[model samples]
Target: MTTVAILDYGMGNLRSVAKAIEHVAPGHEVFVTSDPARVAAAERVVFPGQGAMPDCMRELDARGLRPAVMQAAASKPFLGICIGQQMLFDHSAEGDVPGLGILRGEVVRFPDAAMQGADGLRLKVPHMGWNEVWQRQPHPMWDGIPDGERFYFVHSYFVAPADDDIVAAQTDYGLRFTSAVARANIFAAQFHPEKSAAAGLRLLANFIRWQP
Candidate 1:
């Protein structure tokens, strides 16, 4: 009976995320909404994004969903996915775009050139495919999820939180980066749990069962 609103900002894979959530929590109501009012009325909010950070921010601002999102995150359960997670930060180096500034930090590109191997082959940007997430702290949102589980990720930027204590999980591309973060009622993941198969479903289930 939990009412979950998946914010449709015109830049994310909204259907897939909603479908996945429905699969995980069958009877829960899932609504894909661009309206700030509906988003505010939901029991939980799921923010999902896949495109550039700046574009997503502009669209959210254009639609007047920014304040609603922040308000929902203030006391309700907020789950951010992929770019949605990055947007929670202060800024992103991707497009010189300012983010929601919810979390105090910047999203930076992978240190690809700086992490060259002995053969001088630089690590590629836009890390795509399945990557393992290392849990840093116990969270109700991560309950029943195991360590070393691979999740789907496709992004060039990663979150670097100013407060290390808020980091709930870490993942390595060229180096270790904050893959998941949790602060009070806000929880976010850099990877796409929708595309991560069973392990991903467990995460969605946990989010559904989580009490704030």
Candidate 2:
């Protein structure tokens, strides 16, 4: 069975993400850990996070888990969710913060207030709720998932990768932005698959079964 480690940096919805993975891969071992040793030993790693980019970086650094996470992504299958996805990049404008630099590019705020619609009007930050993902490339990470499938999202900033080839899926808020990305053994989603219902489960299942 695959052993998956959920990096616990004290800022993510760790339990929910872990529960979703456990529901899909009952036979696989899923551990929520802050220990670098366990993360290094795991076959796969899931990095889930919420809140500002700077705080997330600080917590990861504080726990001394940043290097371990970077190593895992470089050598094994790594799945990043929400802020976890943003951190894989070079930086984020959310808090004028630097990211883990696993992937090139930076996270920026949604452009054009009107693009988010009138209900979301005046709200310059925190793009929340369910949104559909537009798949761009065929990848194992998104296998069995349909195009234009809606997923839960709750963030103001989004990843803008330097390389377009790594973008596997996109979603439109103010504009079309990178929602899912993949390169080698590393895959990430800006939306919360754990909160996206059946579509989310399918994604988790795919990740569990995916061979690097």
Candidate 3:
């Protein structure tokens, strides 16, 4: 049976991510683990997170899971969620922190002035609630999900990849931003698939059967 490890670096909603994966892949072994060995052993690795970039980066290293995470991202089907997605980039505007650098990019906060609708109404910073995610490219993770499907989001910052070719999806709050990225075996989303209801669950299910 396939084994999936959810990297528990003390920042993300580990249980929720695990439960979602479990719900989709009932026969697979899903572990919420801090053990580097287990992470390296798993056939699939999930990196999920929330909170400040600095703290997330610190906690990941404090637990000595950085190398394992990088290794998993390199050779396995890796998934990152929310802060998990931001942490994949080179740096973050939040706390001026550097990320895992697994992907070449920077996490940037949504500008305050740009936080307005075309109608002239102000939008919130966090960009909370459901918003349409436009599929930028064809990907396995987008299987069975509509192109303009809405996903749950609760983040102030979004990734700006150095290479646009890596971007899998985009969403607009006040302005368009990279909401999801995919390259090789790595797929990460700025939105929470766990909390996104039907479409979200579909995404998790897709990840279970994804070969890349």
Candidate 4:
């Protein structure tokens, strides 16, 4: 069986993500882990988190999971969620933090002054609730998931890759933003598939089945 490790660096609802992956990937062995060796040894790795960018990076360094995460991102079919996605980039405007630099990008916050939606209502900072995602490129992760399907989001910051070629999907709130990015064996999303109900589960299922 393929072993899936959900990197736990003491951030976000790790169990919820673990449970969601478990629910969809019954045939695979899924475990929530912080051990670097376990993360490196897994067939696939998932990095999921929600919290302040600086705190997440600090905790990851404290736990010494950095190298393993870097290794997995380079050598395996890797998935990043929420702040997990942000951590892969070179930097984040949140707390002016530096990320793992796995991909060429930066995380930026939604402009406070430009928070007006199409209805002319001021949008919230966290960008919580469901929003439609426009798939920018074809990917195995998008299999069975219709383009423009709504997914759950809860973040003030979003990734802006220096190279637009890596962008896999986009979403609009106060502005159009990169919601998902794909490069080689890695696919990271700013939305929470676990909290996304059916479509989320389907995406998880696709990840489990994806060869990348």
Residue-level lDDT for 25 in candidate 1: 80
Q: Per-residue lDDT of 33-115 in model 1, one digit per residue for the tens?
A: 99999998999999999888889999999989999989988979999999999999998998999998889999998865776
Reference-based TM-score of each model? 0.95, 0.94, 0.98, 0.98
Cα TM-score of candidate 2: 0.94
Q: What is the lDDT of candidate 4?
A: 0.94
User: If the candidates were sorted by their TM-score against the true structure, best first, what order would they fall in?
Assistant: 4, 3, 1, 2
lDDT of 2: 0.91
The reply for model 3, stretches above 4 Å from the true place, is none
Residue 94 lDDT, candidate 4, scale 0-100: 91
lDDT of 4 by residue, 106-159 (tens): 999998775898999999888999999999999999999999999999999999
Q: For candidate 3, what is the lDDT?
A: 0.93
Of 1 and 4, the candidate ranking higher by lDDT: 4
Model 4 CA lDDT for position 162 = 99
Better of 3 and 4 by lDDT: 4
Q: After superposition, how far is residue 22 of candidate 4 from its true place, in Å?
A: 0.8
Q: 2 or 4: which has the higher TM-score?
A: 4
What TM value does model 3 have?
0.98
Q: Give the lowest summed-lDDT range of ten residues in model 1.
A: 111-120
Tens digit of per-residue lDDT, candidate 3, span 1-212: 89999999999998888888899899889999999999999999999999999999999999999999999999999999999999999999999999999999999998877478778899988789999999999999999999999999998999999999999999978889999999999999999999999899999999888997
